[model samples]
Target: MTTVSPLVAAFRQASYPVGGHGRKNIQVLKEALHEFDDKLESDIYGTGESIEGFQAEMAAYVGKEKAVFFPSGTMAQQIALRIWCDEKGKRKVAYHPLSHLEIHEEDGLKELHQIESLLLGERDRLIRLEEILALNDEIACLLIELPQREIGGVLPPYEELEAISAHCRANGIKLHLDGARLYEVLPYYQKSAAELCALFDSVYISFYKGIGGVAGAILAGDEGFTAKSKVWKRRHGGDLISLYPYYLSASYYFKQREPKMGQYYKEAVELASLYNSCEHVATLPLVPVTNMFHVHISVPKEKLEPILVALYAETGVGLIHYLRESSEGVCSFEVSIGDAFAQIPKELLKRTFERMANMLQ
Candidate 1:
């Protein structure tokens, strides 16, 4: 038996959306399970019809020669960088300072792969092409996270992104896209996944982030890259015996939600506009380019957390799960619009922000 914290319990039982789909209930689980009721099982080592079918579909979706599924994005991306480093005989890779590989993966690349990270650009801004050009060191790869997540989902201008990609190509550096939130930004990019992927040597996307899968990631690249990745995947213990459930959920949601991301992006813009209008709340980036953005509240976390919890209790609107306090004592939280947000009327969201403003004052 396991014990759950009171806040965790409240979030789980909350009737409203609490950030992303982290609080999926039993009914939702059963519905997703029903989707796989009619499907046959995949192979023990990821060779069966369902797994191969999803990988092929994703490869075609991203315009890659091949795609391999990994149990986690951490494994997929580290392996991708390792492969590029091994091929080029350079241990250095450049990326934004806030990149997941740098900030979130707990130095796995440094410890496991012996890869050194060259941090590029300032925090909370898109990496400029001049920043890459100024680097004098030899590097095997340049990892770019489209709509960089930690910086309120900001993206480099399309022209700048193209320039960077061109520079990487001219310098013989492999460009890999950490497109964990790729689907959410496609509408803003106004390009198909394939078109964006065409610029990179490899791309990594998460099944659970925007795709709403159980848990998995797809690393797509040329056939040789994917073949080598498969071996590394096994070496890294990501070769699960049965990954059919993740495959089925990813396939189902990719079809169901990928097509409607543009609508979600639009909704996010509308909601962000309303939030920005509030007196005490401000959205980072000032406007949203994708379906995700950061919300900063003037109130301290000590006060804002309870207000949010009470608001959910009284109005059945779970605006956020928790707040991350900044150095200045202001609290910031992320808003990721999805099916849950699509259900709420924009007027109601506006009112919610207004009410929050009143509470903070």
Candidate 2:
């Protein structure tokens, strides 16, 4: 028998609204698994109709000449950078300091590809046009993340992004988009997916993040670029024997949930507004530019976790399952609005935070 932590137990037993997807019940898991049953009659390998269908659909949707599926965004991004570096004969790539490549990849870019990351702009802010203008070093590519995830889903102004794109083009530097949450952020920009991808030489999108797939990523670019990426995907051992499950789930969710992102973004803004009204709890960025934002609480994690657990135990509302502590003793957690969030009433959400704030007092 395994022992469940008190916090985990609280989350498991709660009946009211909780964050993001609400712990995938057995029924939900079965439903997702059944998607594979339908796919079993189709091609099983990476070479067949199922994988090719997803790739073609994604390419057309992103306005790329081609799209290649990969097992993970980390592999896709690293390979994209490697391709650009090899083509440009320059090893440097520029992106924000908080980029997944810089912080999460554990220096794989430097160690594996000998790619030098030129950190651009200040942390917790959008990379500005002036930063691009100031870069004198010859670089392979400029990678930009829409709704920059690390900084509360912040995005640069549309004009600034266009200027940066133009600058990169004029300077003969390639541009790649780390659009893991691209679908979620599209409603705010009011631009079609293709319009946005048109500004970049390459774009990488995660099937799991916004699309709610089990796992996979798509790299979209020109046919030549995608062809090269396929070779690299094989080299990186990302070429799975069969990708039907990932493709089927990705394709299914892309159709079902992608259209609802605008509603999610609207709900996020409304929810954040409610948080701002409470004491000791605030939404980072004050306004959400996308469907995700961070909630910063004035309580330390050690103190806050118990409160969350207690609240859930008493009220059946699991407000937070976990909290990340900052150096200043404040605790923060990300709130990503999706289908689960739609079920939560705005008034109840407001009351929950109000209760949390009152408890702190």
Candidate 3:
């Protein structure tokens, strides 16, 4: 563990948020809280009419016939796959090997739903059409995650995305989108969220990621699909007695942070390019398609951890801290930027990162 000196302690006090907190106008949250407080009656719940109102707005935003809110994307995604399998009378779903469903869900699809995954695509890189095309016809659904997160936020090109969409449509295979970071991809795609969402049969979006909500996710599809999912959601024990807080926070964050997405993309690209020029740093994909990218820096394992711990204590600059030990015994570190930290001066951050690299050498 790295010890924090007094100098580092002072720097920590001067650093910005490690998460999205005061990044927006205080009045926005004040009004949202006021609305939340006004609705804090007995049960603090919404009728179908009130729930439907929120659903309608979200559906229209994503160009879907209906939308349903769940406490999490995990439930929404599982429900989506279950619905797709039931409709098509198939048991297998195709997705990238590194998909959140496969890696993060603890085999819920297999254990709970008795559904199987085909697990197509490369693990370290973005999965392409040839990789997807190799799958057999037993697949009931295909899930595509825009800006694949685990692989350092890489994405398939626009034309390739279109080609895959076309293939799914012609084959009668249901397409489900894991759009947790869909908002971050729009500026580069030059398409509205609704337009991009229209390409899939079902689209799942998280309110907590780029939107900065406290917690919530919405799955949008045709009215029948979403209505069916509500039952599955209840079956899976996801129906909440009250959801007004999540709704209000989601709504507030959506309204406030959605506009800054374009600026974030610009800054991300600039930062990635800057890192690429440094001797010790190489950026994933060499450039960023969205506001999120990774800085892969080579450093010695012995020096890396202490420097990182010191940097965090000194500057609340929280970069992604993971070290992989190669056969040669070298360590690689990554820096990830989100809305909370994206506004900091990119040049200054890059300089500090380079200085850390020098210390390791």
Tell me, by TM-score, which candidate is best: 2
Candidate 2 has an lDDT of: 0.84
* Sequence-dependent TM-score of model 2: 0.94
What local distance difference test score does each model get?
0.83, 0.84, 0.76
Task: Quote each prediction's TM-score.
Answer: 0.93, 0.94, 0.86
Looking at candidate 1, what is the lDDT of residue 186?
90
Local error of candidate 1 at residue 355 (angstroms): 1.8
How many Å off is the CA of 110 in candidate 2? 1.7
Candidate 3 colliding pairs: none
Query: What is every candidate's alpha-carbon RMSD to the true fold?
Result: 2.1, 1.9, 3.9
Q: Rank the candidates by TM-score, best first.
A: 2, 1, 3
Clashes of each: 0, 0, 0
TM value for model 1: 0.93
Candidate 1 lDDT over residue span 1-361, tens digit each: 7986444455555666735654555554455668775656656786987788889999999999999988899999999999999999999999999999888889999999999999998886878788887654399999999888998998877878788788888888899999999999899989999998999999999988877777789999999999999999999998989877677777777888899889888878887887788777889778899989998878777777777776666666667666788657688888887777766665666667778777778
lDDT of 3 at 186: 94
